[model samples]
Target chain A: AQRVTQPEKLLSVFKGAPVELKCNYSYSGSPELFWYVQYSRQRLQLLLRHISRESIKGFTADLNKGETSFHLKKPFAQEEDSAMYYCALSGINTGFQKLVFGTGTRLLVSP
Target chain B: EAGVAQSPRYKIIEKRQSVAFWCNPISGHATLYWYQQILGQGPKLLIQFQNNGVVDDSQLPKDRFSAERLKGVDSTLKIQPAKLEDSAVYLCASSRTDGLENEQYFGPGTRLTVT
Candidate 1:
């Protein structure tokens, strides 16, 4: 079975400080990974995907297959950046992209 | 374009009761999905629909949970004889079928509380 693991249940950081939310995965084949974010009272949205190699909202995640990790990082944290973060992988079940998500990490940036 | 829409943002029911949540996907989206999110956990895929057909329901507790996407546009998820463990948020999301990067759009979600 495939699984995603976000080791941090909560990460608290001061505003302007660097932030890193760790994510690891267990899968047998090459993986397609993504980071999703949910802000206060907002719907869950895609922050970035490893395949696109694009940065969104100053956040970036690099897929390290050797390490089996795709950690999300930002140079500086902002108050507005406090939200729930989820790491997901597209499962290879029947060719349809079924997302397998981690337990999630809540990031809180304080002033 | 309008995002996915879900109704009854919150619901409460007793154990052994029944409840349902509704969802309408974005226009022309060919794929729809349902997920369950516990209070402190990430959303888990409960079901997936492709144009009114079930692509996957492997995670759904079929004995107590059921869902239908009729007309391939609107969907409803039902939980009968609800359990306390079923308290969670039910989220609806949809994605287009054309591109390889099928980025999903999500709804506000229906929060269920079974006491």
Candidate 2:
């Protein structure tokens, strides 16, 4: 079974402050991790993936296999960065892509 | 490319009533998924389809929930005898294929309120 865990239900930060949204996972084999964001009145979209190792909108996440964690980090929080963040995991055993998502964290960036 | 599409942005019904939601995946995409997202929780996969064929539906409540993708392009999910607990956002998503890095694109979810 594959499970993603986002410990924070809500994370609040001031503008320009560094932000870190923690995410942890449980999977037996190698897993592919991803972060998806849902903005106000917008559909969920991919933010970043572990394999890509590329940052999007100043946000980056590194997969730590030993810790079973993939924490999203941003150098400076912006008001527009407030949204719901979800962490998901996928594996190849299913023969199809099935993402197991974690309970999202609502990020609130205050000015 | 156009993103995934779903109908009935919102739906309200009494318990025991039936409701259905539709979805149209991105053009050329071959896989579709139905997910149920309860308030304050993440989306949970209810079912998955691969080109009109049922691929995974282990978590779907077969007794009350059913879904189909007839032509491999569009899909529908039907919930018979709805329950209060069923009130949540139903999200439809699609991906080009089950490739190693194919990311799934989501549709603006249909919010269902079971009164």
Model 1 global lDDT (CA atoms, 0 to 1): 0.93
Q: Give lDDT tens digits, candidate 1, residues A1-111.
A: 789999999999999999999999999877789999999999999999999999898998999988999999999999999999999998554366888999999999999
Q: Give the clashing pairs for model 1.
A: none
TM per candidate comes to 0.97, 0.98
Question: Looking at model 2 chain A, which ten-residue stretch has the lowest summed lDDT?
Answer: A89-98
Question: Which lDDT tens digits does candidate 1 get at residues B1-115?
Answer: 8889999999999999999999999999999999999988889999999999998899999999999999999999999999999999999999996234799899999999998
- Which consecutive 10 residues in model 1 chain A have the weakest lDDT in total? A90-99
lDDT of 2 by residue, A24-105 (tens): 9999988889999999989999999989999999999999999999999999999999999999999866656789999999
* Chain A TM-score, each candidate: 0.96, 0.97
Model 2: CA > 4 A from native: none
Clashes of 1: 0
Q: lDDT per residue, candidate 2, B10-75, as tens digits?
A: 999999999999999999999899999999899999998889998889999999999999989899
